[model samples]
Target chain A: MTRAALLLLADGRFPAGGHAHSGGAEAAVRAGLITDAASLEEFCRGRLHTSGLVAASLAAAAALGVDPGDLDAAADARTPSPALRAAARRLGRQLLRAARATWPCAGLDLLARRFPKGAHQPVVLGAVAQAAGLEPLDAAYCAAYESVGGPATATVRLLGLDPFDATGVLARLAPATDRVADRAVRAAREALDTGVDALPAASAPLLEISAEVHAARTGRLFAT
Target chain B: MHLHHPHDGHGHGAPAPSGAAARRPDGTRRALRLGLGGPVGSGKTATVAALCRELRSELSLAVVTNDIYTREDAEFLLREAVLPPERITAVETGACPHTAIRDDISANLEAVEDLEDAVGPLDLVLLESGGDNLTATFSRGLVDAQIFVIDVAGGDDIPRKGGPGVTTADLLVVNKTDLAPYVGSDLDRMAADAKAQRGHLPVVFQSLREEAGVDRVAAWVRERLAAWRA
Candidate 1:
């Protein structure tokens, strides 16, 4: 596997339909939870530790050859908001389309047959990592980065925040993201023997609640 | 690393394109995808509404609109009763109108695929980009052919300005021709500039106020459909 494929998958412009949804940043912005660079940084920090860690763990587990079906179920259980669940599945399906076209493999084909509609995005991300021949840590890193990176980018668009400030937010979170990735890999490794329950299931209640609220609002920019 | 992907031949329900504009997974012929892009208030939505009214009887059609607010144009079509609610969908572009149609088209692709899945055997699917600058154009992967709409009122000099949309679109439509005199836009100069920019490519001058304003565009679409079937 070309290790550089990780960069391709993790790139914000990878075209997996992430541009439309703001990773809950739109809701946060609308609710006045993220008013400036400092608030955005704090929001990113919270997400990196919670949802980021959980998503990274699931992706790492999937990359480590865990059953995607079980991981998908675990993801469903972890995501409390119906809106979030729908967004996750929609993103998963979109990613699968790009993945199957980008990296055609028997495994991805089976995934398409299994969840013709979709699975959770992290489950698909792990599957994509496996198809790309990336290591579990790489999958963890990809998911961990996406968790904060998406929100940071979206906050920039939503608030018209300085692009450099947003990039700085991602830069500040990188070290923490690395730690999250490492912890996720550890959890995924533990899950290999102990089962997926051993994986991180950290929750961010506000993100979930705001997501449900965002989905209900008709006049909005982001999907969730 | 080798990125040579072999056709495993299991593309059932695959959303991306292959044998493009050719056939669906069920072995039925797919609809021709046409794109309409232009600047703000340049009559992109009006043209779409007119196209729907003119062609809906003879052709089965659907629309996918990309916009910052996301639903206004789609809602406009719905309010006008251009097509059933199910046939029209909106894609959020996060205010980057061009990205949805050009840079990363996955969302738009899925929108069209979903439309086809829900109400299918469509003769055409028109993907309308949110109003943007002249640089915005549809990715070939997203649409079979594209029409770039400019209006006499926006600027008579837009064709001479000649960006990608003006030069490369399969069809360049200079809309609001009736407003030319009112807006001080020279019709002859605009036509000449369009001809110089597009050469052999087609351009249509339209005014929705006319008795059969959309007929020319409708005829062009029908010709494209016949050619696609051929």
Candidate 2:
């Protein structure tokens, strides 16, 4: 229940293997969907409402003690791209390794045993939050923020965009991120009674489709 | 990957415990993980290739390459057919090769573990970091030991300047000794600088063009494996 664990999990330097991924920003940049700070904003906004909302809701549900298996299936159902699904599970496996080491809870260990290959990333994220004694709102915030934050950081590297400007984009989206987190928490609350059907299932086709293209791409910097 | 398999065997055994655990989660002694790092054009990949060619016949080995953008390093090893394709893998660094090797090492860690799980009881795993700077060194958490490679043409001054890679790596390799004659790089001075900085740490001057170019490095690896097994 310590507040500091949230910061540890959210830190970009957490060593959870997030640095190698671009959150679909590379595909967007190569597709010319993001050339500067402005287009980057549009991309993030779209992601925050779509896939971002879905991931946050899933995480929030897991943190509220929803069954990880159900949340994982829900996550897969919401994601269209196989490449994105694989990446999510890969990230989930890595995060579980780190979370088990950091939080050392029975639930985290149980999740690892169940999904040896991996569960979905947001499902793992929520379970990790539960293991750390974090609330659903905190898990929702982490998922919502990372949904946009990963892309913002990657764009800084991809476009050589001004670092401050890229950060400014995150700052501008703070209000929107909060709204998404709040909505995600509400959805998670509904999910508690109605099963995973109550969780958000929003999808961003561009992100999913681009992730496939990105996975097939050679000579690309980021993994996805 | 046996997706339909029951709960326990879904992937490889648990990740090899991080740091220097002698045994994997599956309860077998793990390979000796080694890291190779240096500046671009310093022959890091060539050295890895050379080592693979020299050792493949006698040992069970694998390689994990960290590349900045492309899978060029992994592809190069594949094109060479050094080890079976399954024995080698690549971890993309997102343009920060050093971070994958040194700062945040989870990706590289997983690559090695996966390689071991797939084609294992491996005696050695050489992790070749993407070309980086003199300051770069593999995190101890990532690899058990590290070799820092610098060529004569990259400046004999590198060892004297003495960053962590030069001073602290388990082995300091001054590669391209044959090029020293033509590059006007003083090999003796480089050796002296390396000795001064490294003290008792081993340094091997290698010219991959030579007949037994990789022998000494291979011997160093053998010795490490012996010690690791001991």
Candidate 3:
């Protein structure tokens, strides 16, 4: 049941406007920072390690009943780039809206109200997932799926890769997703035990730079 | 460590204000959310500038701009002094402008909410989609009404191209009509094509360089706002 919920949340067709974004893949691709599938895989792996880690940690905290506002602030601090901070908040707000419509909960609604301006996407997702009774591990999976799967799916459209090949790539990355989820679950347990305030900061400067460049270009396929 | 204490106390003592509760009791002075979307350099920023100039006196306005990489559009509006800097919110879409406005709409919605929070009871919120392709259209879920902007410079036959945006926007604005003579675009043909494409929806031929082109668009928005209230 949790797996199904994670799939639903992570699905590219969930209409959260994720299709228009490549999560900095477009800029990296254009700058030759990422070339071919190998580089793309490496990029995804790195993202999984950095931004993905932050998202998963936040999601896990939310699953553990952490306040969404606190999670949002943590996300904001973790993201050093103004551009990325904006994007994360944007995605978070949208995801929260959809989550509210699909699964209403007091905790989620309260979180939505806390960041009237905007909240980070992962934080919101975590809060909503917790409200919906998803386990921390499941929440972590959903976060990783979105952070990684979104870019991978976008790659298909941007690179014009065969759908079969894309599916193959996703299949190969399935184990990595599991590994990442395990780490996130462990991290969340540690955070919950030590208090979410004790979590360490993780920021990727290169990704931040790439996102800023992606934002400036007049011609581009994705939003961020 | 000390910074965390106050926040924790606040979180525990009181529930954060909900979005629904943030609304003014009267709610009569709600803002109309307008979405602008089209290809890059299609003069979306120019149109926004023109609208702010035309409508600022009559309406309480705010703007939410989705730029792919920078706050350039918001900065442009700021430089033009269209509205107070606080009234304008920028969402660095980071990837595709369309996603922020259409697919996800969270960032844009939050920006709208933020503007409302900062400047209560705005008459309208203009959301400028980052320059995008012909396929881009604002989600009805995001904006009360949307304008699909295409310049005559893009091509006269663009209306005939039959993209979702051209056919379905609340208002189809054929901007840069002044450039028509230079670009070899026949205004009449483009108008007719747009009309054919949109059976009943209104289409306006505008040259922002003209004295009152934006006013007409603003008037159309006013009508929509009136209808929304009614």
Candidate 4:
């Protein structure tokens, strides 16, 4: 079941519309913030801490049976970049389509019907996980892994880095995923304990600015 | 607007629907998703425009263009009036165009979906990759089939470079055939090299500048669409 869930989430064909985005790696790369594998590692680490934190939290909430609409709104509020926000909505819509096709949870259908305007990826991922029978921690880990791991893998090809070296980067990231997942689980537990109405809210601003600037650029490699 | 629900842990008690359930019924009307990828200035955008002109009348169509910095490809198609303004969507890849089409693919998928949702049904959706060097290819997850465009002007020897895009694209289009004589490109040699590299796959020598060069490509697309339906 875990393998099936992973296959559904990691297939790259799940219709989440992730193909057009490179997270914030493209912007950071253009800003000269990330070049070599070491720099890429640093950037990924930061992402895991900031944006990844938010995504994991949301995923955890969804896995714990939080309403998809609430998670979507929370994710939207947390994301700052208009471009990234737009990209997130794009991804969310695709995820919705895929989720509806693969696992038509009533909650997911409700979320899609209620707010078709602008849902984010983490929110949709959370909803899909809840519908897919995954635990909150599992969903949190999936979100964090996808949010960071996909870009790290893409970096290998984009920068022409050795595949072994790229795998090494991912290996180093495994522990970090555990840490993020632990935090997310704790947060989800806390939210549940306090009643889902008391879920914590957080946002990242610098990343949003970077996304906006990245979207405005003329020569780049990733979409966001 | 808070719509909070308690952490019931029972949401999964009921079986969730599968991803295929979300697709439109009759699925036959679903457009074929085709990806166009190649190195910079290989005429991917030109090829897309040409395909639209050649097939739009016979088939309902839409285009999704990936550009690293701007919406140039979509704009070019719009300016050329290849398809309706609403049918063209541009994804600013912000980084390597290949990453979006080959690595992540979410944004492109969303654009395609939006086009489908808005247009009801389309016969084909063209995903034009941002310009990149050889070795770039579409993720099979993102495209049903893909065409790799390489211009003779870039050098006829590019086919022998043996990159994944050149060797793996379902159809390899050696574009800008008109520039062959001027650039000293040997069309026959390039064709032979590509044929050798791709085995049974097809290759087309095209010059979008010509009146009907895109006809062969359009025919190929029709064949694929028919096969997809069959």
Candidate 5:
């Protein structure tokens, strides 16, 4: 697997429709759950263990050549909020466009044809990773890091928080991110034998509930 | 498998792999896309509304609005009844309108494509950018042509400053000309500075409050459309 491909996929400027989303951070900020770098760190940590781990495991599984159709269903089963599901598919559809343009592969084309509206983003990310000749660990790392990165960047914009403070928060979370990716890939590998049921189902109830509220908001900075 | 296929040139004569110039699977050309970008309250929405009123009788048209936060721009167009509600789509820019129109255009592209799919055979699609700074401009990949609107009330110095939007736009519009005298702006200086900054590019001085609102801009659109079809 090429390391540069991983960098390209992980770049924040990949142009996959991620800028409009805050990954539930906008809702958290509006609710005063994240006010400064320290609270932002706490929010990201909670997310890394729950949503981040789940997304990473799914992406790793997809990268390992697990059927994206089945994994998409598993993702749906795990996410309870309809708003979150829509956002995931919306972003997934955008990623599919960028990935198709960047790395044309028959599998990616087939998936695009099957889910024109989109599958979950992690499912598409994993497929994109496979198409880019990246390892399952690369996909896992991409998903895990993005899970926190989106919120960190959004916080800097929303609160006028110091950009360095946000970067520092991400730097501090690097070790945890690595551990999560390791766990995610292990779970993905196990799923190859025991089926996708072996993947993590860690849930963050507040994130899901807040996502619904954020969706219902008439005027919001982020699309959730 | 071949990993890297060369992307087709978009918005020019070459067939696009996707976005504005991308043909349907049936190999038919999509609509011409024009972008309107400028500073806040530069009469962009008013121009779009006037253009819709002026041209809707002869051609199929749709609009995609990039708003920083609220759907105010789209709402205003809707309230004006310029076109049916279905023809207007709004894209949230995450407080970065320039990024949505230029750096990463996925959302705006999606909005445009969906508009065509839903209300199709369109002759034109106007993308109205959210109010932003003078540096903001549309990506060539996103629009066939772009118009930068700067009202006389904003300041005649805007043309002298000559940022990317003012200098490089396909057409520069000095709007709210009727308010020029009230605001103490010299139209000739604004015009000369615009000429100096833009060289051969066209600039239109317009006032939507006038009887011939949007005629000059509509004529420009017609010329572009004719050239595109040719």
Candidate 6:
């Protein structure tokens, strides 16, 4: 697997529509749940082990040639909020465009044709990793890191928190990110034998509920 | 680390077959995308409303408005009855309006593509950037052409300052010309400064409150469409 390809996918500037989203950090900040760097780390940790792990596993499974349709359904069942579900599909469509242009693979095109609107972002990310010639573990790392990285960057913007402290938060969480990715890849491999049910079902109800509330409100900065 | 890869012909080393103006997934040419960017209250949305009013009957057109906090711009277009609700879409910029249009255009691109898919075979797609600083400009990957709108009430010296949007836009529109005299702006000086800053690029001095309002800008858009088709 090409390590550089993994970096390219993981990069915040990949143009996959993550910038407009705060990964629920905007709502968290608004709720006073993530007020400072320390709180931000706490929030990221909770997210990394929950939604982050599930997203990473889905992406890893997609990289491992699992059926994206089934994985997308799995993602839907795991996500309780309709607002977050719509956001995922929207981001997924955007990523599909960028991935198709970046990877130029027939598999990506077929997925695009299949889910013209979008499948789910993690599902698409895993497929994108596959097209980019990366392994399942590489996809996991990309997904796991993004789950925290997106919020950290958004928190920097939302709270006007020190950018350096935000970077430090990410650095400190690097080891945890690795662990989540490892667990995610293991779950993905197990899914191949049993079923998608073998994958992790970790959940962060607050994030989901906050996303719904954020979507319902007006004058919010981030989309979700 | 190999910073480059075999697909380097495209973005991130993969040949990109499509972008702002590229063909749709079905191999049909996409709509002509024009961006309108300017400072706050400089009449960007007003200009979009006028253009839709002037051109909607003649050409298949849609609009995507990047609003920072709310759907005000999109809602205004819808309330104005300029276009049907479906044709007018709002993309939240997450308080960074410039980034959405210039830096990472993913959300805006998705809005545009979705518009085309839903009410498509469109001839033109107008993107209005949210009110931002003078330096904001649309990325080439986002728009085929761009118009920078500034009002005479804002300042005549704006042209002389010459930020990227004012200097490099395909068309520099000096809006609210009727208010120019009221605001004590020098029309001649603003025109001369625009010429100096833009060299040979076209500039339009207009007032939407006047007779045949938006005619000049509408004509310019028609010329652009003609060129796009040719």
lDDT of 6 at A76: 96
Worst 10 residues of 2 chain A by lDDT: A100-109
In terms of docking quality, model 3 is acceptable
The per-residue C-alpha lDDT of model 6 at residue A145 equals: 94
The segments of candidate 5 whose C-alpha lies over 4 angstroms from its true place after superposition are B1-17
Specify the highest-lDDT model's number. 5
C-alpha TM-score for every candidate: 0.95, 0.96, 0.78, 0.74, 0.96, 0.94
* Residue pairs in clash, model 1: none
**Fraction of native contacts under 8 Å reproduced by each candidate:** 0.50, 0.61, 0.25, 0.43, 0.47, 0.50
Every prediction: chain A TM-score: 0.99, 0.98, 0.92, 0.89, 0.99, 0.99
Lowest-scoring 10 consecutive residues by lDDT in candidate 3 chain B? B1-10
User: B1-230, model 5: which lDDT tens digit per residue?
Assistant: 11112432332222122464346543566788999999999999999999999999999999999988899999999999999999999998887899999988888887887887789978999999999999999988788889999999998899999999999999999999999989999999999999999999999999999998899999999998877766
* Poorest lDDT segment (10 consecutive residues) of candidate 1 chain A: A215-224
Question: Against the true two-chain complex, what DockQ does each candidate achieve?
Answer: 0.56, 0.56, 0.24, 0.25, 0.50, 0.39
After TM-score superposition, the amount by which residue B108's alpha carbon in candidate 3 deviates from its true location, in angstroms, is 1.0
lDDT of 5 by residue, A1-224 (tens): 68899999999999888999998899999999999999999999999999999999999999998888889999999999999999899899889878877897677878877887789999999999999999999999999999999999999999999999999999999999999999999999998888999999999999999999998887788899
* Cα distance off (Å), candidate 1, residue B91: 1.3
User: Per-residue CA lDDT of candidate 4, range A23-44, in tens?
Assistant: 7776676678778888878878
DockQ of candidate 1 against the true complex:
0.56
Question: Tens digits of per-residue lDDT for model 3 on A152-191?
Answer: 7777777765667667666777788888778877877787
Report the lDDT tens digits of candidate 3 across residue range B126-165.
Answer: 8899899999998775777789899999999999997999
> How far is A67's C-alpha from truth in model 1 (Å)?
1.5
- Chain B TM-score for each model? 0.92, 0.92, 0.87, 0.88, 0.92, 0.92
Higher-TM-score candidate among 5 and 6?
A: 5
